[model samples]
Structure formats: C-alpha cells, structure tokens
Target chain A: MADLLRLDRDPAAALRETAQRAAVRDWTCATLGLGESATVLVTELSCAEPGCPPREVVIAVFAPHAPRRQCRIHCALAELDESRVRAAWLAPTPCGGSHD
Target chain B: MTDTNDKVPVTVLTGFLGAGKTTLLNRILTENHGQRIAVIENEFGEIGVDQELVINAEEEIFEMNNGCICCTVRGDLIRILGSLMKRRDRFDRIVVETTGMANPGPVAQTFFVDDDMRERFALDGIVTLVDARHFGQQVDANEEAREQVAFADVIVLNKTDLVTATELEAVERRVRAMNALARIVRSDPAARAAVPVDSVLGIGGFDLSRALEYKPTFLEPEYPFEWAGRFDLAAGRHELVLGEGPDPDMGLALFPAPPVEAEDPARVAAERAFKWFAEDVEANAPGTLLRPAESLAILDLQGTGSKRFPVQVDAPGRYWLVTQHLPEEFALALHDPQGRPVRPGLERAFAAGHTHDDEVGSISLETEEPLDPRRFSDWLSRELQAQGASIYRMKGFLNFKGVDQRVVIQGVHMLTDNTTLGPWGEKPRRTQLVFIGRNLDTQALIDGFDACLAD
Candidate 1:
C-alpha cells in the first residue's frame, strides 16, 4: 500500500532529486495539472475490503488533460480491447472487394 | 591456409536507377552494419560518394563500357575478384552495383569461370532495387531489364511512397512475370524496414540456376517501351528496336536482326538512317535537342574540328545520348547522304561506352584496352574520367606497381566509383575498357586515354 505513492525509479538519479524537492508542495498533482494548487493533496488509497489493488490513489481534484493522456497511453500500450489486435490472431484478409 | 575450403561471398545490390540503391549503400556504411563490403555503384549522377570517407577502398563507380560489344569474358570482373582474394580479411562481402542497363549475366559468369575465384567466393545472390514508380517502363524497354529482375532473388520495390496502389500492382505483375521466385519487399529508404541492410542483403535475392528456367514471350505484356523520353536515365547501353518483337508463331528461328558489325559496309547504311532519325526528332521536338548533354567532337578540342554538333540527341531522364563519328577516310561516303552502296565509315556511341564498330558511316569508339590482359588499367580509368559524360561502361584489367597480379577497374557512365577486382595469378596485362556509346570518337578518346597511362 505504501509503494503506490511513488512512480517507477528513475534510471538516472538526476531527475529523481528534482521530483523529490518539488514533492513538498504536493507536486504530483500539479505535474499532472489535475487541479488548483490549494485543492490537491497526496492521500493513500484504502481497499473497500481488507486488501485490494490501488493501495494509493491520487484522486484527480481536476483533470484538464485527461482525454489526451488517456488516449496516448492507450495507443502505446493498447491494453484497451478495442484494437484489432484483440481480434482472432489468424483472421484471413477479406478478399470481397470488387477487384475488377 | 592451403585454402581449398576457403570460400568468398559476392553480394549484389541491384535496382533500377533512382531506386535508393545508393541511399541503402550509404546507410550500410554509416551504420557499420557488419563486415567490410565492397560497393559497386551504377550511377546516374556524377558524384560517386559525397561522404568524406567511405569504408571500402575496393568500392568503384561504373560509368559505361563497351562490354555489350566486347567478348563476354569479363576479364575486369575477374581481376576485381583477384584483388579481393588478396585482402581476404579486408572485406566480408563483395557488393557489385550493376549499371541500370546491365543484363547481370556477364557479371555472374565471372564467379563461375575462374577456378581460383570459384574456390574463394561464392555467388551471394542479387538484391534488386526497383523504382516502384517507373518499374513497368524499365522492365518493358529491353529484355536486359527483365533479366535484371529474373536474376534477382530479392526484389525491393522501392520508392513505394511515390506510387499509388495500382501503379505498385502493375509493377508487381511485370516483376512477377519475369521472376516468380523472388521475394518482393516494398519500401522507401526512409522506412525502417529498408534500414536494416541485412534485411535486403541477408535475404537470398538471386538464384542464377533458377533464373535460367525462364521462357520469354512478348505477349503485349503491357510493355512500356514507349514511356515518355523523360525518366530517370542511368548511364548504360539501351537496345532501341525499330524491329517488332519476334512473331511467336515463327518459333525459334525468328531471331532479331543480327547486330551489324562495325567493320561491315552495311553498318554505314544503318548509321545514316539513325542520323536522319535524330535530325527529324530534333526538328520536331525543338528546344529539348539534347539540352543536357554537350557534344564534344573535335579533331582538336578547339573550335576548328569541334562542330556545333546538332546531330547528337540526349533523351529525357538524361538516359540515352545518340551521337555520330566518322573516320577521315570515309568522309566522302557521308557527303552525299547515301542509303546507297557507298559505305560511310561512321561510329555510334551509347551509355555503354564507345563502339567504333561501324567505321563506314557511324563509328562507336569502344574502350577495349581494359578488356585486354595486356594494357595498363589505372591509366585507362584516368582517360575514362576525362571523356566522362560520354562513357557508358568500362572494364579494365589493372596492375598496381607493388602488386604482381592483375586488378580490375570497372566504370559506369558519370559514376566514377571503381573497385579493385583483385590480382591476376598470371602476368600483368593491359587494362581493357569496352566503351559503348552513340557517335563516340575513338581516336580522340585514345589520345585522352594516352594521358591516363601509368607513369
């Protein structure tokens, strides 16, 4: 549950310290541009039951760039099921076109 | 090592002109893709390589040669192989970039004929780069174009970005008719698929024995021989047929017109007819009268012998330039405009270098010194450079002072990149350069050639 509060470890330690110093003012919310500076807060996530995933969730006090970032993440990862990749792996090419 | 087991691999990079063959070559060098590769460039441009330094010293630019006229022994190609055998550790692959007009048969023959070369290097198949845009036109003009396709085991339908789907399909069909066995990959040099040099070379692009299993038919295969004169014209000889395709019903005996020997009196008659054709084409076409090529025919480079050469015609795509040369003795035969029996000792030259085959009316000054095993090659290369624009292809057997065997110098048109083919086990001989061109001047060329003589 405590691990959910941070992002992945930076390979180059240089950017880590930059992120660390800015954390005093609850920087993750500001970096995400999710809300007004005063409204955002860093809070740990609690499971509805005893222990589930998302042990921490930075609730979006605001979400200005939500659509754009969500779409980009979806494209790169394509975990979203709508992609043709989700279709039958061996689907034959539709040869129904009027080739004439 | 006694070396019976040692084998050399020859890799061929072939493509229609402007199909990014050079672009692919540059990437191969800059990336340091693998072992050392000797690049043979078939050029449409003057600069061989713009880079300050290229990896392979054996890399050579092919201008034009009279190989089409000379014996198909390909002595120069063998010599290049001889040189490669010496620097066994220097290069891993021998990449031969054939002229746009090349047939590839003679180049391949080099691998089979020489026993020593056969032992050292094996044929590594051909990688053909096809200009997806003009693929149809190139394949249609002459069987040589089709031969390039058939010989290739891998065909890169390059410049895919420039063509529509229909155009690509037509090109694909023509290529398929010529070669069904080849693996076709469509790409632009910018595409990542084309980047990995191994993708093109590592794939077996050609199989000679397989190519021989072919049947050529002129079934109106959507032949594009009449494509606009304007296209990407690389330096090499083109066989322009005034005669129709052999009638299929006539069977095997229906041979095309036997090439008129330059020494034959009939060759003079053909040259006059060709000259009249050029003059008519210019009068009708007007301003484009060979705008790209500046004709140079002077008893002296000075104004006296150097006439305003209006008879010469440089076609669009800057491809073929037709010119005429006449021997001083046959001057009278041409003075009266005769399709008559009086022979005119003239010569015709094309992109394949000089051919003084017809000495009566049209003379093609063939640069064959390099073809001879007796001449000096480096000197011939220098001579070829001076008469640069007029050259089609030149192959010469060379000898560097320190080396005991022969080295081959192969040149194509304005692309002066040449490779050291290797050393001859036999005594060093004169470098032979077979020059094929339209209206090429042999004597004047010889004078320029004299200058390239080794000091």
Candidate 2:
C-alpha cells in the first residue's frame, strides 16, 4: 500500500498503473469536460481484504481551488469502462483516504 | 541489477488520417516538462513530419504475422530499439506513430509476444486519436478505423471544439459501443494547450499483464504436428484407418511395442521377428514377407498418407502405430476386414488434439540435451533458406556445448537476430524452439534438430 504509486515495482505493475491512469484521464475529460484548470490523476490500489480481488483502479479529479473527488473501478485495467468510471467518480471520496 | 522499471516504455499511437495524432504528438513534445521523449513516426501519404525531433519509420505496415505483430517491419523496429538501447540516458520514453489505417493489434502484441521485444520494451498503452468532426462517418465507412478504436486503451476524440456538445456525446457513445473498455477523451486540438500528455505517455496499460485472461488464444497450443496416442496391439494382421476428417499429408509406421514382462521369453523372439521383416522388405519387392510368414513381424506394409497396412504378429505382443503431420486421428481396429477379434473388447484410443486453419501454425522441439552450435546454425540456415517465405517467425532458447550463457535465437522470415541472455539462472537447462509457419513437416524438422544434438 505504501508503494502503490511507484511505477517501478515490475513490468506488470507499471502496466497496471499506466493503463489505469490513461483510462481515468480519458473518462474524466469526456465526462467532466477538458479545461485549462482541470487536473486528473488515476491510481491503482491493491485490495488486501479477505476474498477481494488483488487490485482496482481509482480516479481522482481536481479543478481550480476545489476539493478533490475520488472514484474507483474494482476491476482490471482492461475491464475499465466509462459507466464504471463515472459511477466511481460520482461516489464520495473516502475520508482520510490517501491520494497518489 | 537491472530493475523492471529500467525497461523503456513505448506508446503506440494509432488513428485514421486527420485524427489529430500530430496535434497530440506536437503537444507532448513541446510541453514545458523536462522529460526527453523519442518519436518514431511511420510516414504516410503527403503529410510532412510535424515533430521537429522525429525518427522516421518505414511506412510498410503489414498485416498480423501469426496472430501477433507484423514481422515485415519488426526487424526495423528491433534494429531501431537496439540502437536506442546503446544510448540509454537520451530518452525517458518512446512514442511510435503508426499509419492512420494501421491495425494496433500487432503493435501492442509485440511487447509480450517476442522475447527480445519484451526484454527491451514495456508497452505503455495504445493511444488512438480520433477526429471528432468526422468520426461517425469514418468508423462506419472503414474497418481499419473501427479496429483502431477497438484496440485502443485511450481514445482521444480530437477536434472537439469543431463539434457541438450533442455531436461530441454521440461520437463518444459510438466509440464506447465499439470498444466498451477504452478510456475516451474529448480533445480540443485548437487549444494550443497540452492535451493530458502525462496521462497518455507513461500509462502502463500496454504491459500485456492480463493478456492470458483477456486473450486466451495467445496461450493456446500451437504446433505443426500433434502426437495422437500410443495403442497396445497384439501381434496379428490388422488395418489402420483414418478417423473423422479429410486426410492431410501424413506418414504412418509401426514400431515394436515393449514387452509386458521384463524376462519374458516371447520378447526376445518378437525382436528377432521385427529385424527379419526389416531386412526382407529392404531386399525384396514392396509388401513382401518372408516364406515362413507366421514368424514374420508384419505380413506387408507400404505406401504413405492414409494407406492400409497388412500387419502380422508372430507372437502375442504389443506394437505402436505412429502418425505424423495429419489432420485425421488414426485408430487401430482389433479385428481385420473379416471382423474377428485380434484382441477382444479393446477400444481404440484417439489423440486429444484438434486442427487449426491451414494458413499458419507452429512446430516446437524441446530437448534436455545440449546442441552443437555450428550444426544447429547450418540446419537452421538451410531450413530458413528453402522455406523462409512460408515461415513467418521462429524463436528459441538453446543450450550450446561449452557455453555458459543461454543462447537466444529469434527470426522473422529470412532475417534473424541472436544474442546470449547472461546466464542460465537457477533453473535446469533445456532447449526449446518453436517455428510458426505454413506447410510444416514435423519429421523433417525433428530429424534436423536431432542431427544438431551433441554426440
């Protein structure tokens, strides 16, 4: 969890992070509209809960002087979709959750 | 120690002509960020190179080679990357610009499909830029455009400023319908601003990490010939028949099956009988057996490719019917044409394998024994020279006598690239090679490889 933002863990880890970020950025731009003041960051997290899948891609969007909004798609990078991304984006950001 | 992140990331950018790939490329290059990026653009048509720092790539974008990346220009890609590796600190990332009409399947597949490509390059993602103004018409009129969208991890709907908000939504919807999973972006290419360069360039989506689950066919067994099954047959007159398909080019032969009992007296007699039959067939005419036929191994067997053999068994023993390079699985009947039981109540065992399309397939040879490097080089050169056109790709890791490092061999058509992979790590050494091609002969390849084995 501490090194989740690190892209150098392995080839596969880098792939997961890069792919998730690209997808999240695309979804954010398409849904929230592209502007000069908007910045989007996508992060993939490993779920360590019992019976949960190993990882999920989370998206956080920040705009000019606004509170950060975070959302997550509980699936692999290849399975990320607009519907899922939008659902996660609309969901409230968890309190005290770390952002990469 | 080489870290996995040390491998350079390559982003394959694809889109139809006028898809704003150039706009996006220019934006990434000129941005204030201090990262060094190398751009490889496959020049097409009348379009001049837009990026000042661009590496020109050949425009010959070929079709998929053996369900993977195109090998036609793979050599060029390999050579370019090889040179790039020599000066490691120059570029932080690589962006490959494919022709608008090009299919992204092969380009993305190259990352994990080829050992060398996988070793040097980690695919970041496939970014397909789409012109929002004419995307609806282009997707409907062209299959290549549809394919580009289908394979993209990031779909940049460029020129969004030209389209109305409603049209923008419709274009996004159409792209989603074609590829439900791709990330979609509406790009206002007119805005001299950076178009989310950070999100697209370093994204690790192209890692082929989940390839096994997403595309199981990549792991599907690929071989020119499949060994069916070994059947236990009692010594007797029998006929071998093709089962369940149009006959393919095949070679069938019978070998003396081992005896059940180690000290059995019948085993010695059976070996002598087989030796007698071999001498008789070589000296006499085709399908001829010795005068004392009851003691002969086989009564008469001749011809190739789905022909019946009149086989005789002098003793109560076992035998094997080996089938080579054929679509049809062979089954041995206990009784002859008369329908009497040669061995009662024994069912035929068929090989558990299936056939693929006729155009391309693979042949793999794996052995624990070390190979003579010179002999293998000669055999491979001869094979590739005679049938290189039909042979699309060949790759293998081999053990060479007196060499400590693992020898890696890879080739597409006639062109080949060879190098040593440091050392054999903490694993047993073995030789494994696979050739994907058309019209493959398993026996010939097996014989050739056997000749390369160290004596």
**Best-fitting candidate, measured by lDDT?**
2
Q: Rate the local accuracy (lDDT) of all candidates.
A: 0.39, 0.56
lDDT of 2 at B398: 77
Give me the displacement of residue A39 in model 2, in angstroms.
41
Any idea how many clashes model 1 has?
96
Residue-wise lDDT of candidate 1 within B359-387, one digit each (tens)? 11112122323332223344444454455
lDDT by residue for model 2 (A1-50), tens: 11211212476855664566566678777876756445454444444445
> Which residue runs of candidate 2 sit more than 4 Å off their true CA positions?
A1-100, B1-3, B44-53, B61-73, B189-194, B207-455
- Give the Cα error of residue B81 in candidate 2, in Å: 1.5
lDDT of 2 at B121: 79
Off by over 4 Å in 1: A1-100, B1-5, B42-71, B189-195, B205-455
